[model samples]
Target: MDSFSGSSRGGFAPRGGRGARGRGGRAPFLTKTRETNPDLEKHPLGCLIKEFGSPDLGLNPVDLAKISDCQYVASYNWLNDEVPTIVIPGKPPQWTPLQEPQRLKEDSGQYFRDPNAAMYPDYPMAPVVNAVLETDSEFDAARTDVFACGSTLGNLLRFARGIDKAFRFNVVVIGDTVFFMRKDNDPREVIKDVRGFGHTFPEAYTTWEHSVKGSETHQRIIRYKFGGFSCLVRFESDGYIPDSSAVTNTTPANTAVGQGDLFQAFQGATISQQPTINKLGSLKIKQGGSPVPQKSIFDLKTRSGKYKKDIDMSDILPQLWINQIPNFIVAYHDGRGLFEDIRVRDVSDDVQAWVTDNSDGIRRFATLLDKIVDIARSNSDKLLEVYCPGKEHLEVREQYGDGAHALPADLRDGLDGSKDGDGGDISDGDEYYDSDEYGFDNRSDDSSEELDYTACSAHDCGYCGKCTY
Candidate 1:
């Protein structure tokens, strides 16, 4: 991160561009930067935070090669306000029955125990237990989330992988559920979003580091996410684990939906429920399926057959995002500021040179965002409490008693520059796991594999939304 010779200070640039005085003088939440393009709609990490690093380096097409080597990662942010009943089906206190846990043989030679027995509060009125009874969101009492090992993040290893991989931003899983707020055409608002993200997923996440007796101990776990979110996933030659609900290699029809892409993010929600989609009738499956009931948001003249507009998405660039797994823990963040965390296994003057040598725009930029995001994730924990709307569900939180907060010790120690038992030295240098191992690439090697975007039937007009062939 030290490689940049200019402007790489703090979280934002001190002067130049945008906030000249009034207007709140630089948004307290956004990291500001210099930009020329006016039509960027929106980029995942906010706007391009300042020219990546001076024109001396020249501009590179936003070629997503950097994240290609990304092995595993995740994004976390806390949302305030009640859990938003509109998103939950049937409004209040609606509970879905739990699924039966499957019995599996364990090397321990013991039958797999049901988690409902080990984790749920035995007390009938336990806060969490009570809250569940009052909230509309459904859950399988035996399984709180899809990823069960706890922390979805596991110590991963990547040797030398591939080169030509493309990079991605956040993995967004679109859903079928919608916040049915109104009965007619009207502006909709969002209090919280329900984007589900997935990766190999940790069974659970633990703040305390513990060693298992003659076994692989874990501290984190990931559950199946419900909306447009992301989770880290990796492919191993020795074994394969699919991230989506569909079977792997056996169902190409569902491959796109199951491949951890943005569309798949909508696991439980649907576009058909959106006012725009519901009115257009584009919400239903295209190839042909069981006929579905029709819906609408308003009694507009258009719905009265007064207007007609044809749209095509057959050719938009198809994208999927994956997080860069922490190869070597270098720094971390707390609510107050950024800290250091590193292990002693890889260190020394030579290592310092190696780190200093690779310093550039890419590394510097990623490191800064890393600190900023870590801080956000840390603070979010406070905002992410037991979400129970209405007085009846308050007991759920009371029972849970507000879960605790703790960051990874090794990661934190590595970020604290002066702390000793802090695991490793932060000043030594930044070390990414296996340079060639992380990053993304087009999913297929065959030139014949076309982009999944919808193409307009119009001639030579390319990707324009509407063009006649």
Candidate 2:
């Protein structure tokens, strides 16, 4: 990662562009307020807390050989509807290369809604687990050590290396798999307002290419082994390229879902139930689209070309490495929304080199994961919250209130043979502690007061709340 250069407050210098605004300029963007579950805030701090300790970075270099090949496990799409609709093995947006320069619209409207919660309102992680079981019924949940999203793992990696801003996530142990659930105030809460072509460029670039059109987002699940632990990671894919061979051989018949059997049961359904009527909540499962190999999937970014600024691969390699995404697309616009320079590069080598060079940090990251898992497992409640105030040590505390479960009662029971069947109701736990016992200070309101608006931009710091932009 590039070194941050700027104020003593740890804010980085603004990368030059039309969107650059100093401290007194217009606000970059802000998270929208929405009515969320009041219980979310009511979840109290717990007495049992584990402080994040630095691991010896010099010892036990991570075994790169142990990093298993990423396998395509399952996928789903969030359909645009009043109710969340999910299609299994749902198609990702096809990477249709642009032919000419075009003036794209400035991004407008809600930008960062949590697709997981929007699609499966009851349980965010349920769809991934459901899709995994639906794809491979024999999958051994016992052997899987960690189940996480790219965002949570990335936060952990940054925290282990002491490079990230403060973040919080919930951890739940289902069978042997410790799920790191990304917790936000509201699943539908707007993360930020649109300000640039980051959203619009992709809109003009990719095509849905399948019957599952009007899909809001595409999410994929992949399984791999890292540092001797089997990890199942779920990430949102930007888009995908069509395999030439598959495109040539695929016929309309192979890609079409039978009219009579389109919507199938996602929960507890076998392959034979390809067209079953069992519905899991408001989620509608439909199978379509041919599977695209991992190599064809890509991550994309749009940058300003006014200053001839190049897209920094270093800033994004960590994300690609975590997801094992091989391709990257960078579109450079001429400040006025006209993009003429677009490059699609296969970054597999660059990502590999980054892994080798960052071996020390990677080892520490692996160690951090081990420590977190151990802490969660040792907890009597088997539910914990990982919280880090900006530039501070991590706190693994007992879950708030009657802790929330990662999956519904049926899914939880099916996952680990646990029959504490409450149908996914938030139950109050006996463990509770005063915040002062752990010296916990509420700093949530401090971010806005300390933000350096001039030094912040969506491309650079993502309005991380600490540095006002």
Candidate 3:
């Protein structure tokens, strides 16, 4: 078999249609800068060079992306391209390079994994602590949980926050598990590995457990010290069931732990939901059922069970804010004076930049809060007696019924806003909401707090009152 190697050895007369034509019926020349990827240019160039047996191969460069499969073959190496040149009989040699095809650059936002990648990061991007979950498992360590994917860090935070909206929580990337431990592996040494989070494991939760192969397995939940007024949720393998060996398959870990279903079999007791939190920080029944609805923030479906695949929560928050706040400007700056300003229509850019610059801070903040919450809960079991504010309490006595926190009238035409008698006229894509008709007492209540709603529609906000607005 002839080696596919393109050689400096053979030469053949150029055939018609082999090279693209120029405006004046000549062989078009290619410059190095003609292609963004040098490899794209080199592969075709090498093929032409080998086909015609010349180092000085000239043809249309822009036609690289347009080259048919039969005309081009990719190189395995950087430039030692191997290609077989076939000569067609009776075709006259003629050459003129083709014009460069116009191509648009891909949006850089596709690379960001931050949930708020569509919004502003709480802090700047420089202080990001990449808390990677490291394990010594015989199989790949990352397969233990989705959070191990690194890309799902933001999703972890969002899920944790949504689980309990009453208080902020930090996510402790629970490192190393039983699967990663050898019989000779010291549990204490494994516990020490929690230092990767820049904190020492708490003496109390030095041990944890897991459920694998339909059996309850013991493991360690490395609790590190976290401070501040929030809760700590361990992102561990308590509910993670390995579908297969990570060594054999490099699939991401899928958790059996549903959102908001915490403490099924972990060290920490489940934070019980209280009907009404008293001033003394105790749960006191407030008679009728709690007003706040319970639902998952990560659920991509509507209340009607319609899933909007294109709508990502990260992308929705900014749009919701834009709808309410007029004259909003989304801006991006990279310290290099490359300032890109976008309006509401192109607001996605602003969110992407914010996420890129601040994902580290958000993750760290969640971790720190988790540590603090963990320590507090350990020291005082009383802290566990948390008062669920019975959904988010609106101190404001609005005549508009409790639906004051409902979706915008226009967006809620046939939804909650509609049921509340505030349905607006949806004509020509314009909606009008009447405060008087809808029961909203626009008259500012000196006592009322801000409105709270996940969508500008309806669903049970699982969080006590962590509405987006």
Candidate 4:
């Protein structure tokens, strides 16, 4: 990857006459609809335990090493349609340097919506599985320990460090891999209305400089080893910088399908004219994008310059560490909307420093993940819920009611250990909640103390509710 170039002044370059087009025009805001998963609310909490204690700073820190460099396993972009249309291997928006200060519109419409479910309602993890199978024929799902999205892992990290308020997610042991599915009150619930330029600034600053024009969101999957567990992490990428030296235009080798077969499969593939729902409930795969190198990919943010506050690298490092994003761009705007102080930084070193500094928290996070996986595997049903009812402790209980499966039946059958019998009952030493009601309010009586959910973004903050942006 090329080193960062010094800052320069210029007007936003027009993207016309580009070889390929992208989802063009201002990005569309999410709207209210019935696309939310109904089963999310039907999940009744089962068992609760408080075995895992808080991070013990007195203990020596453990090493957290990246066994494998972050690789782009798969990507897709959300298109504006009555029914969601996602183009696989979707191109991320390109960073277009700004030459002149520009006034952008404040964000409007729904503040939060789970694009993963909205795009692939039948099986949200279908894209990740498909991409892995396509790119690597020898991919062993049974050998992998954890498959999760950045948000799910981020929530766990916050819980391990005792920094986040409260959250809940589903844990299903499919095959040998334990899948962590993020659960919100409503999959498409509007947390609140947008208030800042966090959305609009990106629309004005970045260009989807490829055939995937008009894409609303871009999601990517990566694989790595952490804490003795192989993890396949899916995350929403903000965009990528075009760097020929760091990025490859060819698809990964798929030995099972024949060398270059996946590339041939995607050749000339365009966005579907209509929603292409396959048997697995995934959208039709398309072949127009190059696999962006992790080095060229970046995370972006926008903040107010009125206070002249410096963006805290610490607050953002945890997120970048989870995604392994190498580049970071933070644009500062005066309260109104004129962005002038735009900083494009290479945060690879900063992230490493954060890992060393937060080793205790990371060790605890790894242990928490191992405990959850054990609890899920111990249950005969192989379905469990991880609920954190505040900064206190986390509960791992059997999933009850009409809880949904993580993936479709056929895909589950393909996994190596999917049919494994229940290991045994969870240990008797585990604790349980005696309360009849499983409900807990996450809000505070003082409105001022309430978190601004709108400030959270799937890519930058994973909707952790801690970001001031």
Candidate 5:
């Protein structure tokens, strides 16, 4: 056995590919940018660096989403990254955490979590919150029950594509995560760790805060709160510095915590003719967390009987109105120059062709919504109430139907008794009363008497009075 130091010593057969035995041995991973992250000129004039060079991962139906998330995070960190500086001695770090936990929790809508890294406040990336659930399998729903992995993404992106152009993001999901950092490892110092993936995000971004400074107005008060907040969702597939510890994620503190944020982000974006970016940052604590409860898909499939996969397409609301912040910003950027616009890169002709051939917002959104309604409706609470806007897009209506069949059929197809007999369509109530009396106008004789069905659909006579329209 031989022991080697840097210059003259050598022993433990340095393991690696053929290149490792060469005079220059490549480091496993770089602690410094120059150590391992080679400068690949991906952008013009060396403007951009290949922050992540991992071989492309498959964006199968289940993993299609993180593609853009990873790309965005990688691009975001590429800006203003001069060689990092190592700090010694010590000084305090500063951050502007939200006063309210709810608001703070919401700031990062979608995010990545790296579990194998060192844990400390001085870590140079967003500390992974330890309440989210990591995805496991596509074959099971619990694998994605609000888990935000493939199924949710499959359904979400499929539908998002259907969202009008004004609502589509220049959403570039890359395949990695990164964190802003300085070389230091002391907890008493400041932590500017905004971790995520890909390279589309600028070194900074603008974040909106609630303000009421002007007269009688809740106008958007904008300032460069931090150039980074304006970046897109950060991912972890790209290399992160020194890696961060696992995050502790949580499900809705309460089920009542409806997907309102999700829905509103989508709906509002569409209405405003904008792109919705509800950047959700979820992190699951690998070793510590409340046991994630799971609904038995077996019971649900059983209850559905032969209709297990027989989806009631009508259960999907015709238009979910997924208004999100990104949608609005994109829209605003186009029309009013409010948000920065991402340069559309040229995709391969094949990818372009695929996008052109299969791109359909209306159909995509409709199909995915149907799937979500079904998956979410499988709640053991057979009486769960799902709702949507009615005819006017103003009034909310409540219905007593199967949740899984939320949109099994169109609500508009069947006519109620009221509008039919008025020279419109046949009325069930009218036919019952028309037997010996003027249907619907008989007034109140015996209020307690049960209406007889003898004069049902088939018993109608030429006496048009008892007959339906």
Candidate 6:
């Protein structure tokens, strides 16, 4: 949470021999100075903090404190030049030389030199969210309440509450379904990316913002589930929820296929017919009819006697369904806006439909990809009809229509001109909701430009003079 200082600005000169130790025997290098950059402070993020100040969002400090005390077998502290240490609580920590310390040192040295590379003490994603919820408060009431409600971020809170919480980014739950929110590293980068969603979702350009406000929002959302890929690790609390299907018990145990065979058989099954792992041979159940199949399934090898790589049925089955939840949510909610519809039943229905139709392509096609391509081909026209206008911009354009282009000369500035009402900026502050940084920024592009139309046909001449006028 420290504002990075300039290279020339005075900072704690690295403690000459050993780093300074503080309370609980932690490093002082983690200490942040009050130095603030005028330019950075002027940035939207800084301005918001100044205007809003920090408000307590009802999260607990103890939740975040638990992270620092969580047992980590191996600790990699870059602030200290000491070799990676083996951390055993109560015993003096022991350091081990890296296999190629020179390479590590060189790479890390250059990374630390980068101006944008701010140092963050190693910690799981959960505590960061908890800390932010408890401290930083700037988002709108609707957005802030999502986290304050607790249930919205319950799964994530669960992950962070545990010791050694596994880190997963962009994972969110809408209703009964949990989804991995897809996003580019940068929206500007997406504009330049030839294979980006910009073409499919032309309005996606405004999705990323480049300002400090955008940066802070991006950081908070990632901690609160926005962009970046997620890992579906096993937590003792809950298990993966895939579509329900009957497990055939008629198959003979002697003739049953091994885990390797089962995976191979179902690996290619359409997303709809994901392997309904009803049996695991000797690994099926525990003493009192409890299920513990991870170790056995992970140990299974391929038919050629090679260990199955990342093709484990255990993770793949759940992932097959887990990964698709977002798509269902997007298709159902995106016309309105991503995560805009937080209602559980609406979101859950979309998920159930997705699982029924896409998971086991038998309901539709052989695979989810095929279903998507087919749907796109079928709805290609409808998709083109929709434009990616910001919520405010779209309203303005709709009100004015084509005449919007030739609205009164004074009203030409789009929103600024109309006296009655123009779609106001999405958020407070001049930082337009940049699409480049994180989740949907409330603001829209200020510049007046014709909305880009995505077309699937060469026969119609709507805007461009290709086929017919």
- lDDT scores for all predictions? 0.16, 0.55, 0.17, 0.54, 0.16, 0.17
| Cα lDDT, model 3, residue 250 | 15
TM-score of each: 0.18, 0.73, 0.17, 0.72, 0.17, 0.17
Report the lDDT of model 6 for residue 381: 25
Q: Residues 31-103, candidate 1, lDDT per residue (tens digit)?
A: 1221112121332123222222122232222342133321212111101112110010000000110121111
Give one digit per residue, the lDDT tens place, for model 6 in 172-271. 2222122221111211110110110111111111111111110100111211211111212211100111211211111112222344333322221111
Over all chains combined, what TM-score does candidate 3 have?
A: 0.17
lDDT of 4 by residue, 223-314 (tens): 88786778888877767666523322221111113223323222211111222222322254444444667887877666666666554455
Tell me the tens digit of each residue's lDDT in model 5 across 1-469: 1111010000001111111110000011111111111111321111111111111112224222111211110111110001111111001010111111221010111111111111222222222111110111111212111212111222233323432111000011111111112111121211122111110111011111111000000001011101111212211111111111111111112111124333322221122111111112221111111110111000000001111121111211111111011100000021111222221111123232334444343334333433333433343233222111111111111213321121111111221112232332222321111122111121211101221111111111111010100
- Which candidate would rank higher by lDDT, 2 or 3? 2
Better of 2 and 5 by TM-score: 2
lDDT over C-alpha atoms for residue 14 of model 1? 10
Q: Is candidate 2 or candidate 4 better by TM-score?
A: 2
Q: Which portions of model 4 show Cα errors greater than 4 Å?
A: 1-43, 49-51, 55-61, 64-69, 244-282, 416-469
Tens digit of lDDT per residue, candidate 2, span 1-469? 2221111100111111211101111112212212122233544566557885444323334574236767998887655544445556666766554444556655443323355664455688877876666566556688788999876887777776667466677899876778998776554434343354555555555656435444556778998988677899988777775542333211212222233221221110111111111223644444544456788887666666666545445546777788888876666677667877766667777778887877777888887787788887777366788886644577888776677789877666556634234423212221111122122122211002322221113222333111111
Model 5 has an lDDT value of 0.16
**Model 3 weakest lDDT span, ten residues long:** 3-12
Error of 3 at 441 (Å): 65
Model 4: weakest 10-residue lDDT segment is: 5-14
TM-score, cand. 1? 0.18
Cα error, residue 190 of model 2, in Å, equals 0.5
- Model 3 residue 290 lDDT? 9
